[model samples]
Target chain A: MNSVAFVIIAIFTLAAALAAATLPNLMHAALCLVLALLGLASFFFLLGAEFVGLVLVFIYVGAVAVLIVFTILLTGRDSREHRGFNWSGVVIALAVFGCLTWAILKAQSLTIVPPHIRALTVRQIGQVLMAGYVWPLQCVGVLLTAALIGALVLVLEEKR
Target chain B: MTPTLQAFLIVSAGLFSIGLLAALSRRHAIFILIGIEMMLAAANLNFIAFWHFAPPPHPSTGVMIAIFSIAISAAEAAVGLAMVIAVYRHYRTTNVDQFNQLKG
Candidate 1:
């Protein structure tokens, strides 16, 4: 059933995220991150946001993951980092988690009720994006282009 | 609970804390960058899930924000990697702890 699939996806997503967080070797962590991203994309699909899911997978798994692995290959291999959790970090991390848990519950209780909202289809999103939210969308594109140029310039300087 | 949105938020929280730990625990510049990226991903996940559950009346800001976040994240990765390359070139290493020449 759909509900079963949702549960399965949630389990995979959480497991992959935990792996991404805790995986020791840089290479292994990156790999786990790829898995986590893929799981997230699938979750998007299950939510009926197929386009968003594809974009997540495309950008995170296809592009970001490739770029990271590329950097790994370009950098020397012998450089190793010590892997393990510190007591202080764990304590701080737990504190932060507790705060976030409280916030989510508090917010959920106060949210405006809309139990029967319709899922926004891809077509509906396109219409809204182009007509109502065009400015932000275009601004994002411009920023991405600028970033690409900056990356190229920096890389060139590095190579020189 | 029955795997509500709250559960997803908790997962995001755990991942985010892990990310913050990695960012703080390392003096290496590249690892710091990775940790930052992980945190960004966590935030993006929250945005997407919130959008899914809390749709606006007309134009969904959540989807638009998610799209923008993806673009911003891509930009960040590009810039961050470039900075890493530059730092590595100048010092022949990327460890933040090793850089002491500029302390004057």
Candidate 2:
């Protein structure tokens, strides 16, 4: 059952990712990206990280995907099909994948099965965030506020 | 047999490579941003997988880092998209290759 689910999710994710990477239409690519993100969220669930999975769906699919689509729409004038594939980039990607796969396969310790463990709950996550990770949490809050303001400033119309 | 750590790592690697391809090959700035987001997601998956496969007594470190990573990626996406819009407004084009003003 576990292997079957993993296979299905992996196929779904990789296919959507390929589409997003290679699609000529910007809008279609953006939508495919959402699908791919959904797949990743499911993977997070499969790994027993329910809270992280929910956050992935909320932040990535809900917010980031919408932002990407909106950006595409806002910059729709040059929405024509992209130019031909950059073959050199394809070569580089393939080369990188080959090296990574080789390295992962060579590492024998990675063959072990996942040990059964209790699932992490949202309450515990909150506890950790407010305790051990308090400083980072505060820092992220400040960073998000800065990013929000900076993004707004960037897109704001020039007053000249 | 159930999927092992190697399997997850391989999948993550594949996702990362695909993302690199998108970022490197795509002409549009938005596609590049999508690629970057994909890469970040791949990294998050790695962290979670390792966390799950670790010994019986698990620390919340992996989950915590993943959460933080998600927040950071969200901010990154917003800022990146905003930059794309600003560049589009100034240059009237989203093709990354055409933004060569800084080229020596």
- Candidate 2, superposed: residue stretches over 4 Å from native: B102-104
**What is candidate 2's CA lDDT for residue B13?**
96
TM-score of chain A of each: 0.82, 0.96
Predicted structure 1, TM vs. truth: 0.85
lDDT of 1 by residue, A1-160 (tens): 1557767876786677566555556677678778877877877776556777888888888898888877756654424655444567667877898899889888845344323446777888899889998898888888988998988887784232
TM-scores of all candidate predictions against the true structure: 0.85, 0.97
Model 2: residue B75 alpha-carbon error in angstroms? 0.5
Q: How well is candidate 2 docked (DockQ)?
A: 0.85
RMSD in angstroms, all models? 3.1, 1.5
Query: Candidate 2 residues B1-104, lDDT tens each?
Result: 77888899999999999999999988889989999999999999999999999998899999999999999999999999999998898888999888978422
**Clashing residue pair totals per candidate (backbone < 3 A):** 0, 0
Q: Which residues of candidate 1, in runs, are more than 4 Å off?
A: A1-7, A82-86, A106-114, A158-160, B55-58, B101-104
- Over A71-94, each residue of candidate 2 has an lDDT whose tens digit, in order, gives 888999987656777889899999
Candidate 1 on B25-101: residue-level lDDT in tens?
66556566667877887787787667666635534777778877887988898788787766666777766777767
